[model samples]
Target: MAWLWLVLGGLFEVGFTTCLRNVDGFRHVGWTLGFLASVSLSMLLLEVAARSIPMGTAYAVWTGIGALGTVLTGIWLYGEPATPVRLLLVVGAVACIAGLKLTAGS
Candidate 1:
C-alpha cells in the first residue's frame, strides 16, 4: 500500500513537472492549476508513503521515477531529444532507484 502511494506520488510528480513546461511561466491559467493540483497530490502521497519508508530512500525513489517518467513523456509527446546517452542515463537512474530500495530492505 505504501509502495503504491509512492508510485502514485511519482506519477503525479511527473504530471506536474510536464504541466509546468506547458504553463509558459505560469501565464497559462489552466496549465498552472493542473500543475499545482498534481504537485499538491504528489506531496500528500509522498508524506503518506514516508510513514513506513525511510525518508531518504523514499525521496530518491520518488524523484527518480518522476524524472524518468517526465523525460520519457517529453520524448514521446514533445519529441524531445532521445539520444542513446539520455536513454542510458535513464537506465542508470532506474538502477540507482532499485539499489536504494534493495539497501533499504536490508
Candidate 2:
C-alpha cells in the first residue's frame, strides 16, 4: 500500500512538472492551477507513503519515477530527441529504480 502510494505520488510528480512546462512562469492560469493541484496531491501521497517506507528509499523511488516519466513525456509529447545515449541512460535509470524497489527495507 505504501509502495502504491509512492508510485502514485511519483506519477503525480510527473504531472506537476509537465504542467509546469506549460505554465509559462506562472502566467498561464490554467496550467498554473494544474501544477498546483498536481503538486499538492503528489506531496500528500508522498507523505502517506513515507509513513512505512524508509525515507531514503521512498525519496529515491519517487524522484526516480518522476525523472523517468518526465524524460519520456518530453520525448513523446514534447518531441524531444531520443538519442541512443539518452535512451540507454533512461533504461539505466529504470533499472536503478527497480533495484531500489527490490531492496527497500520497508
Candidate 3:
C-alpha cells in the first residue's frame, strides 16, 4: 500500500499548497495552522511511503501530483491563466509521472 500512501501524500501536498493561499503571509492564524498541519501530514505520509518506494520515484510522483493539482486548482479557482501551452505542459508532466510509475517495476 505504499503507492496508496504516496497518492494520499500527494493529495495532502495539494491541500497544503491550496491552504497556503489563505495564509496571507502568515497573518491569517487559522489558515496558517491549517497549512502547517497539512504540510506535516503530507511529509509524514511521504516518509512512510518512501520506506517501500524508491526515493527518487516516490519524490518525483509526489511533486508531480502536487504541481499538477495546484496548477489545475489555480486555473479553476483563482482565475490563473489556463493557456493552451500551460495545459499541454501539465499533461506532459502527467505522462512523465505515469512513465516513471510504470518503469519503477514496483
For candidate 2, write residues 16-51 as lDDT tens digits: 999999999899999999999999999999999999
Model 2: runs farther than 4 Å from truth?
none
| TM-score of candidate 2 on Cα atoms, chains taken together | 0.97
Q: What's the C-alpha lDDT at position 7 in model 1?
A: 88
Task: Please report, as a residue range, the 10-residue window in candidate 2 with the lowest summed lDDT.
Answer: 97-106
| lDDT score of residue 20 within candidate 3 | 100
Q: What is the lDDT of every predicted structure here?
A: 0.94, 0.96, 0.94
Which portions of model 3 miss their true places by more than 4 Å? none
**Superior by lDDT: candidate 1 or candidate 2:** 2
Off by over 4 Å in 1: none
The RMSD (Cα, Å) of candidate 3 is 0.8
Write candidate 1's Cα lDDT for 29-58 as tens digits.
999999999999999999999999999999
Evaluated at residue 90, the lDDT of candidate 3 is: 100
lDDT of 3 by residue, 1-106 (tens): 9999998999999999999998999999999999999999999999999999899999999999999999999999999999999999999999999998899888
